[model samples]
Target: MPATSALRKAKLTVTISGDVINEIDEIAKEKGNPRSQVMEEILRDWLLKSKKMAIEKDIEAYYISLTENEKKENREWSMIATESAKRTWND
Candidate 1:
C-alpha cells in the first residue's frame, strides 16, 4: 500500500481499560483536544522514541560485532585524522 494511503485516518473500535480512558480524558480536557487527538499524539511520541531506541541498539550491536583488529584500525584512522586536522590548523 502507498504510504499516504497507509497513513490515512481509519476508525478502530477498541476496548481500553477504564483507568487508561480516564487518563486520556484528563489529557483531552487539559489540552482542549478530543480524546482521539490526545491518544494519537501520545502514540506518535511513543512510536518515535521506540524507533530511536531500536536504531541506537542496532548501532551498538554493529560496534560490538566489530573484530578487535577492526576496532584498532578504526582508532588508528581516527587518530591520524585528528593529527592531520591539528597540523592543518597550526599551519
Candidate 2:
C-alpha cells in the first residue's frame, strides 16, 4: 500500500479454509509481515487483475462491433505505429 495518511481502515470478519489460512500465515512469516498486510496485498492484486480483464473484454467487444472498413483502418494504423516504433528503436 502507498504511504498515505488519508487511507482509512475498516474491520472485516470472514471465515476462510484452514489450508488457505496456513498458506497465508507461512507467507506472512517469511516476509515478516502481518497476515492483514498479506491479505491486503493479495486482494489489491486481484482487484487490479480483475479490472484489467474487464478492460480487455470491453476492448474485445468494441473491436467485434467495428465495421470491416473500421477494422482495416485500425490494422493500417497499427502497422504504421509498429513501423514507427521499430524506427525509433533502431535509430
Best candidate according to TM-score: 2
| Each model's Cα RMSD | 3.0, 3.0
Task: Flag regions of model 2 displaced more than 4 Å.
Answer: 1-6, 86-91
The parts of candidate 1 lying over 4 Å away from their true place are: 1-4, 80-91
Question: Can you write out model 2's per-residue Cα lDDT over 1-91, one digit (the tens) per residue?
Answer: 7667548787899899999999999999999999999999999999999999999999999999999999999999999999999999999
Tell me the RMSD of model 2 versus the true structure: 3.0
Model 1 clash pairs are none
lDDT of each: 0.96, 0.96
lDDT of 2: 0.96
Tens-place lDDT per residue, model 1, 1-91, is 6788888899978999999999999999999999999989999999999999999999999999999999999899999999999999999
| Residue pairs whose backbone atoms clash in candidate 2 | none
Q: Candidate 2: TM-score?
A: 0.81
- lDDT accuracy of residue 43 in candidate 1: 92
TM per candidate comes to 0.75, 0.81
